[model samples]
Target: MSATTQDAVQHHDHHGPEKGLKRWIFTTNHKDIGTLYLLFALIMLFVGGAMSLVIRAELFQPGLQFVNPDFFNQMTTLHALVMVFGMIMPAFAGFANWMIPLMIGAPDMALPRLNNWSFWLLPFAIIMLAMTLFLPGGAPAAGWTLYPPLVLQTGDAFPFMVFSIHLLGISSIMAAINIIVTILNMRAPGMSLLKMPLFVWSWLITAYLLIAVMPVLAGGVTMLLTDQFFGTSFFQAAGGGDPVLFQHIFWFFGHPEVYIIILPAFGIISHVIPTFSRKPLFGHDSMVFATGSIAFLSFIVWAHHMFTVGMPLAGQLFFMMATMLIAVPTGVKVFNWIATMWKGAITFETPMLFALAFIVQFTFGGFTGLMLAIAPADFQYHDSYFVVAHFHYVLVNGALYGAFAGVFYWLPKMTGHMYNDKLSKIYFWISTFFINVTFFPQHFLGLAGMPRRIPDYATQFTDFNAMSSIGAFGFGLSQLLLVYIVIKTIKGGEKATGEVWEEAQGLEWTVSSPPEYHSFETAPDIK
Candidate 1:
């Protein structure tokens, strides 16, 4: 290396992370905090994956072979909670911490200390969640919906689960507040809201959603705690309260919570598609507006999840229409992505491949979602494996795939070294292939009348369940390749230049790969 660049790096590291664990504990640096968030998410990814594998294993032959029904329920419940909070949400936040400031030319997050609090809070929350496994009742197994009466039956573990949820909610709200403030106030000169990167725009919408919904979630759970212990009637059917009220509150938070997990993914797709296609994102303004519209519509469509709850026909129709309208904005995004790729110099790089798979699979999930939105049809699909198939399509292939694309798209920039292109591509296709195998059969099973969260099923499902189990193992194990690729790139590889991708756009690509510890020390001119 040139002495000049070596000296420059040394100078940058002077105030950077120190040689021990303390660098992580007391540090306020956005990059360090971002690294911590990413690593934590990785840990949770494995934890959640293990839970899912167990679930698949028990369901393999569907004969009560591996685990009993209650234990099986525990696996399913913790798997959803762990993946949603410990893995997917944090994964997005990790990317946000690492990329947002760079994209918008901010010196650092507006609330760096709060960022640390948010990151640190996650471990404690997840630990509290994990602790439930050892409690008397073996975790809250009434399904992630946590409907009362059943949830109230949870033994000593109930408090732990509720408290864990509250902590995670607190973390999300704080992170949202920080992101909103940083973006609203921190953009470099001339970087207007419209001119900022789509990622920034995506997160802005997500932050608003988080702020709106997380507290409602906390309140709902808190009410559950009071009802369970304090003899309140908030969800007690015999008392003056109603159980459906809990569904209303939870879904109010839950529907937007789904978007909170995905909007950042849309942002990731926007950036990745244009880059690999060697084109600008089509209808950028419309993309931004579409995201906002989806957020607004998310609040109204919560009832789509509750169509089976005997709502009046008028109410059901309203929710069904609102849910369907979400497709308009979502469709705009899909078309814009396709248009961005149309007739362009497209390259099926690893990120592009993942992004493409995400589009296709997530769309399939969306179709099922629309079907479920039909209040009449939902009677047949609700709580069935079809619903399971729809969400995994949306989440694993949709949100998680975007996380994969973002990691690969930015790994070079994050590490100052290019990942092994061939191995990464292999990882991508393996995951893509097996993920389909794992979830696709469930669509048929759902249609054939298999309910979710069951430990055993009829003989007719044996073959498909076996295929799904095999696929689940393959898909779950293949993710470690990502961990390996990331480590290999960091330890040593082809040294990356400032611009990792050839046609990379925005301020992020303008800086050094593995950009200095303190990025944007002096803001760059946006124009």
Candidate 2:
């Protein structure tokens, strides 16, 4: 073995952990924190998923059966809050915590103590928010958007929800700052900015975006609190304040927040697709540029989400056109992925299957988003099941699918055992099929003028709603298999080789399966 390899092996021997539960709780190690973030996200995933199932169940028929309108509204609100803050964002952070050090050949995150604190804050924040449901007036019934007038109408739960959101935002910002500093200042001697893996590059941009926008969300929510209690009228029309401004500010942050979730997913896909195809990524420069362009376009397109809130023709047109322009860069990415797979030595592993599904489903979501960007069409579609369907395609099928892909792809590295391939494929197939069944029909329902957030609907919408609900249950239940696969893999299986996949590349692949607590004590020489 070469001198560098010898040093790395010796370094690994020196810093590896002695396994125990206390090691996880009190540990500041990046890999340990990453596991905590992921396991926490998985638990939140089930919690949020259950909330969604309740919404689907209530919407299953033409009338409310499982829940009252107020309870239904609470479910809708908390479902979004938990999923966005609790599940999706943390999942990405978990990916960063785990992969960033290994990818960049850093021994650990720059500020390890803060990393532990950031993760521990999550469970407490979520508990505080969840406790609001049992408060006298129940949880904040306003949507996760948390507009002023509606939010002000809710009970004491509003303050708790707002504070919880603030806590969540703070946690995210700290995590983002840590990632940015580590990637910027802590990379091993030979790793250049551009030479970093796509996952790191994507995250670098995502962190910057988070730092810029999360404060805006915090400020908006803070104003909402003032409006409710301090007698301020930031969103009250009668008090000479315009509620529309809340949207303006919210979407300013909200639009980029959407990119914040998906961009990392893009990074993961960029990494996985190339590895599985046994080829270099097609248009690597263009992929980076496309990601940057999407982040840029995200800001100007905020108003597209508010098209129905009223704007002058020119303003509406400007926002619509800017939103549509996002398709160019996004399209570039799609074509590049397809081209990468063209005539390549493709393997149908679980990760590759999820990546392939993401390409198709995310593109379908993007197309619908483009159609919604048309202001005239949006007027009809606004607040309907179509809007619900659109985001589920993007968020659930897009972001969530990417998370699953990453988990399956990296399981071997994270745990020292290979997952059961037969069970993995079965989980993927069942999820893909049922996911489509759940969300696809909602598009038709939206077109048929079924309004969202309603506890009841007309009898004509019954058939599709029932079908969608059944599919929701199927999708929800299928996740049990995922839980099983993860547990079984962790328990014990066939040992994984250093290179988990036959054609995997990057600094990460250079390390052993279940990488050492302190990886790359001596950095690899990047060729």
Candidate 3:
């Protein structure tokens, strides 16, 4: 190395993070930025969870019990917005920022300044989104899908909501760009594409997906803005526009956005399952191919979400077959996870427990999706509680559980302290049990002809509704234990070794627990 470059590297390494709030505000360090993303996501999780409890409490036993219908709808809309944009997406980004460079032996993200800008955009967007509740119309009551002309009725807060979404889209796109550049350009010597860790591979594909679709979402919302104010008839039937066109546009982005949410979790599972099972991942190359195949199929399956909208027979058939095709790749993933654990020295640690539950419950979601994919069957199921149940299974059990597993698996490395095993297991079991109790009965409710998004329900739906509300409370309250466990681990715990897990492999394990401020100051040589 040139002496000038060597001296500059030493000078950069000598400084630590600044003290107090400015550190978070102005710092370009990837780990600090990652912490910011994670902490923000954690705060938003509770915020969204609280909105859900309101929805559940109102639905617990009755006809307009705690909240009016409009407010209840607002709760549903805000809950989805907060969870999807504010909580889950950022949490995965946090995992990306903190772990990707470590895993790939880079000093940091390829674009550190842009990374800082990306994270800071999220808070402002979410805050503006939340503030709309106090506006004249309360919040947007048209659901997270924001279908018009219902959404166009939103008073005073309409522009704020649209602009908030714009900011969010911009933020996500910037983060995606940063990830793509870093992964493509910054891998250490000898760390070829196929040799990179699974988590990195997952994020790489997810980043591409993000860049591709986020703009589509932006365009849809921009059209919503124009229709609301500028006398454009892009979606207004009165202005020679078809509202169905909006559905086509939105779902085109929306369906891929689902994969954008889950793929990172798939990556997390790949890492966690292998480590806990004490085996190299089964079918590694096939896993890679399957992930790509699922992504490719996501674009074609968008119409399944709208099968009941009176599509042509050929269109329905094509979409039905395409939606079912997704199961091929997903099934490969499920089989590979089980096979990885087969006859291996499996240990049911907190991470593995979550990963196992993810496989089971996510499969339940997939089966329900298959049921919904049949256009004729979807006629009976569309907008019912069954659809609600299916997605929650995929998102909560699939994506959120994967995030939990990642956190538990990596906390030791992040904090340089081992989390309490007993507390973590308790957290896991409580979450797993109540999550089922919360959503499983919704399937029966849908089958029995109950619709979703209504504040009041028929008396016959009371029992399962009550059960779900109770479970919601149990599940929501149980997450506090996670906060406590993380805090306890951070404040003090058993010291962690460099390789926190027994068979944990990767460049990440080679660094110190909690790692240097500038990890891989000297680029690692891959063998």
Candidate 4:
């Protein structure tokens, strides 16, 4: 082609995004889509946050004060569902969409249009899920596990819940496939697998986990659908179907689902800690291996969640040992983070504060997890507030905090302005303080033998429950500060340079702040 003709084509391709809603609806730009995912997840954070407050409110004095028992159960069930699928997963996806291509020096995700479709599916799925609460029997209240017999009791909400899950599973798998293909096929020259950023590597592993287990979850729920509507007895004891079989299928997916929510958080922490510490990651290659090891161990340890339901002694022992073994690699990661910070110029930036909290609180969660891993001990902990405390620490303080850190760390780059540091710090301290107040007391409540999912509790559980409820209210309100900071950053603030953080490293920092519409019209050379 002539030079003039070639230049025209290049100019057309490099034009800015279309104006108005059409750009968001039809554009395949990764950054635009990433923004959409982040905004959506933020909205969900509030939605799920509201539901949690209702739960804490009811449990405050434990006399069925704010909501009825059935509605309270709905709150618990829907809160978990929205937070897991809506809030955390999509927030991580936002990170992947925005950062992966930037990190790997790729122009865009390998499947840009598929990326659009994957995200679009989520709102529809969430709508279906939320609509269930108004349905004849209220939303699925068998807890997020959606175990049968009990879940089978759900009314018109059953089919909605099932199909919504199917939509979520499909969305997750597509995103995973896109991430896998992008990383494997689109990395710039010299950006080998081993050289990829920790965040990129973590997402790569997480995508694989998503692809592997989402189908299992989809199948489990599909069976539930069939059993409910099509006369299948997959879990009906009267029809010779064992309910325990469903537990096996659900936890097979559920166990790894925890890692799926968390591994990306792990990735974010890996990046944030090193940047603030002004040090190279202490053990980059070992971090990668430990991540893979955790993923592998995640699969074998599902049975530990099922020990209370009954299993052969040998089966229990195998699962118990496998669960405990995960600690080795997890401990390796913790040590690596600590080592990276040891003897370095560490500054407690807002991002660093959240990351440090993640490491410390997540370790607390992990220890509790280990305690639950003992098959003998699990029999006592099962279905109690203790179990609730363990996972919340991992999810809220661990995964959610990691997401918060990433937002602060990258906000400057994404929006071309530095966030309000003072407000952010205040937000951080309040959130941290309240999150502990909310979940830590649950550990005590569980030890005191307070069963979970109950609307009213024994008088003996009142003091701790009241404290937890107060913390829950404080934590939920504190999140509004995040919304304010994000908006204030986007509208206007002190301008940020390409390298937003002093020690920031990667292809992303090499680009202009709030990188150009196409990110990279030409691929970056990674040396």
Worst 10 residues of 1 by lDDT: 1-10
Model 2: lowest-lDDT 10 consecutive positions:
9-18
Per-residue lDDT tens digits of candidate 4, residues 177-278? 999999999998888899999999999999999999999999999999999889999999998898999999999999999999999999999999999999
| Candidate 3 global lDDT | 0.93
After TM-score superposition, what is the CA distance of residue 228 in candidate 3 from its true location, in Å?
A: 1.0
TM-score of candidate 2 versus the correct structure, residues matched by position: 0.97
TM-score of each: 0.97, 0.97, 0.98, 0.98
> Which RMSD values do the candidates have, in order?
2.4, 1.7, 1.8, 2.0
Report the alpha-carbon TM-score of model 4 versus the true structure: 0.98
lDDT of 1 by residue, 1-527 (tens): 15466567657455766769888998788888888888898888999999999999998896888788999999999999999999999999988999999999987899999999999999999999989889887998998989987999998999999999999999999999999999999999899999988999999999999999999999999999999889899999888999999999999999999999999999999999999999999999999999999999999989899888788989998999999999999999999999999998999889999899989999999998888888888999999999999999999989999999998998888899999999999999899999999999999889888999999999998998899999999998998898899889989899999988997898899889889888786677866
What count of clashes does model 2 give?
0
